[model samples]
Target: MAVQGTPEPFVEILMSTVVALVRRDGPDLSARQFGVFLTVYLGEGPHTVRGLAKELNVSKPAITRALDRLGVHDFTHRQVDPKDRRSILVQRTVKGAALLREIRAIMGEAAAASDEAAPGGATELRRQHA
Candidate 1:
């Protein structure tokens, strides 16, 4: 069953789980950090700090701070853009991908538990996203 114009059922749960994991495994990353991460992940091409800052409606310094924090967790890597030596690009590392996978697993477990406790749990999650 598909709900048109709605995000998938697990997305919100996965987001919640990932937030919890980030809180536990790394320095505190605000919802802004999560937003930046998700945007970069979904982007078709590489992401630059300035671009992300613009996308997230934050200052370059603020995005840099977030990137610095994420750096401590190996969640992102800063590299000089070859085309534009003055600019830096942030790329997600393998560790970051693995961590995201673990968080997704946690979310799946939570969704299952919620479903067990109350039916249509996944649908409820979708509604929350909506």
Candidate 2:
């Protein structure tokens, strides 16, 4: 329990979000898998396995493993870059977009609840950082 008028710690909100996500009805992605998914979808596009590895500071194989799981759910797919066949670009899918929306909604709801519990806190991470 945080002070009624102060910001909730980030971990508390994260844990609550994870709990909420876990209780939801959908494929459960590991931290690495979710991280990869978010980086590809939320961040800039034209993402590649190599680029994802570098961005996430993990090995190409590690990213590949996470992609394997994401691909099973059709959350993302890889296509040979038309401009550079040597590179493989990770592409998003409709299902992936939907999942992203669900995730955002869950997070927003969690944040809003946190805001209500602690009146001084912002309901979004961007505002907290700013």
Candidate 3:
């Protein structure tokens, strides 16, 4: 396990995972779009554009733009909030869940490969760089 406060191992794992994911052929999402997607799926919903904007520290227009792209991919959908006609709720779809699963699998494979490549796993890789 990584020692408390040291982010090297975590960074290494994330970098490797991103590299592996980027190499795959599929919808290439922008950073904002990816962030919105992750937030919607991983967070408690029903999410609102305004809520997401606050949580993500961005403008409502920014969240809406990201949601626009996500909607085009069918990864998410928006609905009129019954309680508040002025608000829209972001909802997840089966396609989004499937994509999340695929991303998880890709990251797992990349992490395993990274572990196998080093003698002492991420620690060893860090030592070499240090």
Candidate 4:
């Protein structure tokens, strides 16, 4: 069943990639958690709760909640920022890097599938699968 929304090419790729992610045997993260995970991994670091909240345009509570979930999976861990002594730094883990690789692979497969399924879909592929 197709979802009722604007049918953009990237949307199709996103749906396909998400479907693959759900079917796989691994941590199932919500959109928020995944966003936070990617942001911490993909972007430059020294990432604190405040930094993530600002970067993601979400509330600190929301970032904390997402981090709580990511922590359960060991994808990320919270550390007291030594320099600041007042902020919690959201640090990435080896497990989280593995997940990022998996996501890249899944997104690449989905993008290729999207291109094949719809010739000239022109779906911009995942950024080198990260």
Candidate 5:
């Protein structure tokens, strides 16, 4: 066992590093925006607005507002599902995929940096190292 005087690992360090990295990268979308983008892209469409809201654990208006932001960038488009005309589906545009690729690259960098900075954090990866 390690000495108790050693500084306990904290997730805040990783979060701060990620936030700084994001700022340095000048992201097209904020963290929340990226979350919305990923939720849709990863979901692969034909999902109702309500379903997405539920999946994201956010409110309907929150999803709608996020969609509105995405529309402004032409990152996504909304369409009424044929089977359920009243329900809308969020589809990612080419631009959205390109943006997502950039985000993923940045995230990968952050992950690597975090691992390097915290060789043995409290997280599972650190446990493996231990």
Candidate 6:
């Protein structure tokens, strides 16, 4: 079933989660890097640099740059596509999965906290702003 609410709460939760994650002493990923990381992990496998660029509506070089940072942290890796010699495939690492799990926990906590802070939750928040 679809969750009923305006987009504001979700955005707020995301912002809070990002802030909390950044505040923690860990790999601090840029927004683009985080986007590329999530797209590779949360989406389908065997993702190509070109495919990621298309998915994110960005240039291939931008994807490459993000991958470079992710690679340094061992959060992701790239390999030549065996099927297509010209293509480079983005692959995930155990560390990436662990990081994502941690992020999920943070986001969940932020969502719960936001819900508790506002009666009727995001719906009420939206109404107040309206």
lDDT of 6 by residue, 8-123 (tens): 67687988998998899898999999999999999987799999999999999999999999999999989999999999989999999999999999988887788887647765
- How far residue 6's Cα lies from its native spot in candidate 6, in Å, is 6.1
Question: Can you tell me which runs of candidate 5 are displaced by over 4 Å?
Answer: 1-31, 118-130
Per-model TM-score on C-alpha atoms = 0.73, 0.87, 0.82, 0.84, 0.67, 0.85
lDDT tens digits, residues 96-129, model 2?
A: 9999898888777877777787666554544767
List model 1 lDDT by residue over 45-93, tens digit each: 5899989988888999999988887888788899999999999999988
Q: Spell out the clash pairs found in candidate 2.
A: none
Error of 5 at 63 (Å): 1.2
Query: How far out, in Å, is residue 33 in model 1?
Result: 2.6
| Residue-level error in angstroms, candidate 5, position 102 | 1.0
Model 5 residue pairs with clashes: none
Worst 10 residues of 3 by lDDT: 1-10
Q: In terms of TM-score, which candidate is stronger, 3 or 4?
A: 4
Candidate 6: lDDT of 48? 97
lDDT, candidate 4, at 3: 70
Q: Is candidate 5 or 6 superior in TM-score?
A: 6
lDDT tens per residue, model 3, 1-130: 6577675555677887677678878788988999999999999988999999999999999999999999998999999999999999999999999989988987677666667766476666567769
lDDT of each: 0.76, 0.87, 0.86, 0.87, 0.72, 0.89
TM-score of 5: 0.67
lDDT per residue (tens digit) for residues 10-126 in model 4: 787888889989999987898999899999999999899999999999999999999999999999999998888899988889999998898899888877878888776635334
What value of lDDT does candidate 6 attain over all alpha carbons? 0.89
RMSD of each: 5.5, 3.0, 5.3, 3.8, 5.1, 5.8
Q: Candidate 3 clashing pairs?
A: none
